[model samples]
Target: MDNYLTKTSETERPEFKIPDFIENMGPEQIHERMMASLPEDIDKMPGGFPFDYTMPTAAIASELVHYHLVRGLMAAFPEYAWGDWLDLHAKQAHLSRKPANKAAGSLTFIGKPGTVIPKGSMFCTAATAAGSSIDFLTDEEVVIEEEGRATAAITAFEAGKKGNVSQGTIVLAVRPISGLTSVTNLEAVTGGAEEETDDALYRRIQMEHSMQSFSYIGNDNDYIRWAKEVPGVGDCIVMPAWNGPGTVKLVLVDQNGEPANEKIIQDVYSHIVSEEDRSKRLLPTACSQLTVTAAAGLSISYICTGLIYDKDTTTLEQAAAEFERAVQQVYSEARESGTLIYNKVRSLITDLPGIVDFETFLINGEEKNIVLSKEEYPVTETVSFR
Candidate 1:
């Protein structure tokens, strides 16, 4: 097997390149080769019967080579394989793609005191412009407090990111409780994530293969892998013995590269250490303690002066929004790098559709790159243009 974990140089690594033989195989080339191999007396002209008959054969042969040879090669490597082929690699590595997770949060119910809200009570968000709403179901029974309000834990009716609703969005009850007055979420409901993608599964498989030689007795890489096994976890930093010997601390972020919320933090902890059962934990038996927390969000503000754009084609607000999106794209991809390049951000802004040029561009009120610590991830706080 190719050692993908090894680097040829400090900054360079090997990548798979298609061989010339495979690259040059096409229907036209195959057909010409077939004609040349035949006797000269045979009719191989474009309008001849021999040409027409051989052309179809060549096309079919080319397709077989592409499917059986080209696709087979791709399926053999975790880096290039996708779909079911990727799953096969994952199985060999003892890894499985994380499935989509349902959003979970508390819902506040207001009504007459002592009103019983039954388990499986349903609530929904307001219908969107398309006349659709996400539904949530109560996880257990609860009663209204003396203050005519109570909070109940709830889970989304469906599994996926669509269940992640903002605060105050769940306003309607599917069936009105006799004494219930209103319902809403006090905090943003989060932790919902889509099914893991091919790229994510590939990374885990690569990590699995790379760490095969390393001891899995609660090492930094082991903790990183354990945290990532949770569905909503994106990436994490593991600090072994940060507090003291036999103690490990983990800082995590969600799939969007944002600081994880409490739900995700709890999920990772449960997966790694399992507070209720020490024996159920993934950690080494000798590891004394583990602590899991969310990464601190470091907000980076942008200030641009003398902004120029095509006013006739788009407004300043539109251009700024586009630039903000571009910044987010770069930030998401660079989260693991631990530094945000100032020039790269400026270049993205300059390359926007209506943007012409900016006399000054600053990140977090400076012209220098923003460096983050292991427990920090950058978030776009604000964008201002003059």
Candidate 2:
């Protein structure tokens, strides 16, 4: 993955600098040039007729020049392009930005036996002190069994990561259902992702150009491209011939870079292979077998001592949370390196908000780097600070 998509400190190219010639076309410069062009005898002084007449013309000319300059930049580079312009570039590459996806999961309802939970029944997460809840609607109707429990498929009313709630957080039903007593999720809701960012889309567009030649064959790049076409897929590790000849395996992660959930895995598989009809697959039949699986998550724990923090600005607990976030970010960026450098992790932690310094830091009780297999990606687990 790192080979194909090198993670850089900056996601976008640098801002385009206007040429000196264009810079000289500003209103003031244009006005001065026009004044100079008039005859020496002409009354071109400030507030005079010639001055007032040329000022507006110069201003309009400068505005036109600025507009055309921006249009030219948009036409010349993807970095300057946005919205519709960016879409045009993607279309030319036969790619489109992945749209946001609603989180889907099963909600278990407890109620009177044989009670019907109708489709479109609404549920929501318990509101926090911030005072808002994420709503979900039932995808299908289900009746409570003799055990007084029933599970129904549900989707978030709105798309995006805000809908990915923790287990047991969804405790409220929007409207009263007489027979439905209570509802909650047994597992964490997953697979919710925001629409692909401009940076992310640009990266994919760049990758598309690099892999165009290998697209015809069932190469690793082709498999990767096909898998990423599915919404919610962030990155993929392609292992060709992992099972033997004509076999390909793709280990995937979601948009947040955590291990892909079952739903995402199945979506990628259906997109590339189309199990119902192999002929409909994007890859050729020459790739006799294909397997799509979620990347295994390797929990990363941290232990630190002699932590230094400013209590005026943040508590130890807040600093620890910041450290955890920094660790996760580093892990996500370096996951493709197949090894998490000990120093890199320690550096990020020491730079956390409210953190001044740390006397000691150990990753999983080791001073050495953590190495992972091809199928594994690092996930933040626990942080112990003293």
Candidate 3:
């Protein structure tokens, strides 16, 4: 039996004539021709190439060639991606010397002529570092104190669910809207102003609601919890955080459209504004505030820790992205405090046992291969089943 095999073409080679354009072309001309042939969107942004034209065009051409080759390989399998095939090929190459499947157990190397044998598996060699794995953050020392406190509050509410289900018990409160906190009565000197007019009351209520609609009172952690416990409480939660007269005195209605608990509503309203002030007390030391204060000084990373709880229907990816965006917005104000700036995001995660790889794809002209890259992120997430 033959120990080695060589590739040979079964069909006879045909003579071909070169066109005038083809014969006269130099490397630059060849590159220009290829570039001209690319899809219009391929070279454009948003819907096009990521890099600029300054990068050597040949490098881009090489990438396209590599892509085409991968597609061609994928097309052969019709069911497997190029990455999958490459992984299988690497494994097969490893097993070839082992005596498990042997009509002949001797080793054979298949590669291009004049090429040196591979030192290590191609897939293994090309594998990235535990670049960005979920596990990378499994041990990340991130403390989501705010989120934890929010969770604890929710948990406490959930546990006492049977005790207090009053819509009044879960009142939504707000601090004065920062921009339009106070409104004055225009009828102060009106001759007929002893009693409030219905029209006047309606106008004030509409103004307060409008102000609330435009203001952000930070993440509405409490409102979300209250809404979950009581049905139709979403409207209650939508009330303005404005400090209007009789606003604090206004009755919080029940599900039947009657005042549920006016005293509790007022207390909740007062507490909301008081709580906002209390939280703001930390502003002197707040990372965001410090970023603003040090605008002419330090190059500091205004880091705040946030945790992603499973309670929300949002995925970890979505939560992480949102948190990252929040951080970026905060960090943008600190840009004058440093150079070479970009927003950095780190997840506060905890725990990993069973290992799973994230899916990665390698697409070739005719074949697409799927592979999993091992997880490796710098941040370790704290783990707790409870």
Q: Estimate each model's TM-score.
A: 0.81, 0.81, 0.14
Ranking by TM-score: 1, 2, 3
Candidate numbers, best lDDT first, in rank order: 1, 2, 3
Question: How large is the C-alpha RMSD of every model relative to the true structure?
Answer: 5.6, 5.5, 33.2
lDDT tens digits by residue: candidate 3, 224-334: 222212221111222222344212111222221222222234333433444457662311121121100001112222222243355445555554344433333223222
Tell me the spans in candidate 1 whose CA falls farther than 4 Å from its real position. Answer: 1-16, 274-280, 301-341, 344-360, 371-374, 381-386
**Model 2's TM-score against the true structure:** 0.81
lDDT tens digits, residues 344-370, model 1?
Answer: 888877777777887998998899998
Count backbone overlaps in model 3: 27
- Give the Cα RMSD of candidate 1: 5.6
Per-residue accuracy of model 2 over 1-386 as CA lDDT, tens digit each? 01112333334545555666677888999999999999999998899999999999998998877776556665566665666777788888889999997787879999999899899999999877986999999989999999999998888899899888889988899999888888999987777899987677777778798886337677777877888888898888888899998888999988765688777888898898787986776867788888888889888888989988877887777777777655655665566688999988888765666778879888888899999888988877788888
Q: Model 3, 90: alpha-carbon shift in Å?
A: 47
How close to the true structure is residue 226 of candidate 1, measured as C-alpha lDDT? Answer: 85
